[model samples]
Target: MDPKEFGEFVTAWCPGCGNFAILKTLKAALAGLDIPPHKLLMVSGIGQAAKTPHYLRCNGFNGLHGRSLPPAQGAKLANGELTVVAVSGDGCSYGEGGNHFLAAMRRNVDITLLAHDNQIYGLTKGQASPTTMQGQVTKAQPLGAPSNPFNPVAVAIAMKVGFVARGFAGDTELLLDLMQQAISHKGFSLVDILQPCVSFNKVNTYAWYKERVYRLGEDHDPRDWSAAMAKAMEFGDRIPTGVLYREEKPDFAARFPYLAHGPLGKQPVDRDALREVMETFA
Candidate 1:
């Protein structure tokens, strides 16, 4: 379970990119959790962050733009033995795949979502993304983004998601700790990472995040809904980086009637009988 044995492909990412830290930490987290490459399934949509699966030596599904969730969920449902993790950028997850994000929360699927919230669309070469702060100018928006940036952590908390957490890419140890917790959680888990896109996003640099980011205090209770909401809504001067909320609930795998006997792949079925039953319905 050596971290070095996880990823094989050479990445074409620029130096000082927060993604490098994220990728390395992710491998470390998996190794620490004793999850081998064959047991992990990484899903992602079209974006710079979506290329994470290409670098990792794991089962990967590079889906269409803004559509990583459907396949990830399907794969997990088919074989509950797999550990599913979806990696996506702010633009791909918050803007393009916003609807899917909401749906995943509603279903409370048994999967982890790692959101690379760098605040800008780095893949498109400096564009104002869904999480981009207001008044931050980009190549696509010379006058700055017109709308206010989306608060994914707050939204997820409001939706009563099973788990909501935040991490900083600049802190490798913190990121690894959060990822391990997210993947180990039984129900849906969301970890919104504050990544610094050095090339495209100049505003939110490594130093910029280090100044504002602070960890949640020991007294803070993640189970307290109101308290967690307060922690999630904190922005501007000081930002909290830690678990916001977590509550156990019935996961999709348990609720699905078809999976009552366990994963579909693990159950023995009579294909002829199933086909005959389907023909009767037709």
Candidate 2:
């Protein structure tokens, strides 16, 4: 898990992209966890974020646009032992993939989701994404974005997701720590990364984030849902970046007793049972 071993997935993104920092920090976190590369499965959908799997030296799935979550959940349900991570962009997750995001949170599947929140569509040449700030102009929104931006952390907190966190790409160490924590969490974990799209997004730049971002103090309690919601609402003056909330709730696997022992993918299907069912159908 050395930097050299995990640096292969570097060429897909644009130069000076914030995703590079995320990739680096993620690799560092994996190294710290001592998880074997082969045991890690990275899944992604169509977007710059989806390209992460290609860059990293691990098992990967490059899926359809806005469809990474379903398969990632399936992978986890099939084999809970493997470390499953899904990478997606704001446009992919909040736009076309919005329904799936809501469902995934509700089901409480055990998987780590690293969402690249750049506010603009980079791969499609600078369009307004769901997280794009109001009045922010892009190729798609020539007159500036009219609607309000989507707050992913707020959504996750409201949905009562097991682990909700936010990280800035600039702070590699802190991002790495957050990633590790998210991966270890039992249920659905969403890490909305405030990544600056160097080429397409100009408003939410590194300096803009640096001026506003502040870390939540050590005294804060991640288990407090109300407090976490309040913190999630903070945006203008001091943008809070850290683990917003975490509660050990019953996961999807726990509800379905059959999958409690392990994911279905690793288990051998009963051919006799299938034959009996087929015979009944016939």
Q: Cα lDDT of model 2 overall?
A: 0.89
**lDDT tens readout by residue for model 2, 2-78:** 76666564376888899989988888898888878888999999899778898888899999999999999999888
lDDT of 1 by residue, 120-224 (tens): 998889999989999998888999889988999999999999889999998778889899999999878999999999999999999899999999989999999
Where model 1 places Cα greater than 4 Å from the true spot, the runs are 277-282
Best model per TM-score: 1
Residue runs of model 2 more than 4 Å from their true location after superposition: 279-282
Taken over the whole model, the C-alpha lDDT of each candidate is 0.91, 0.89
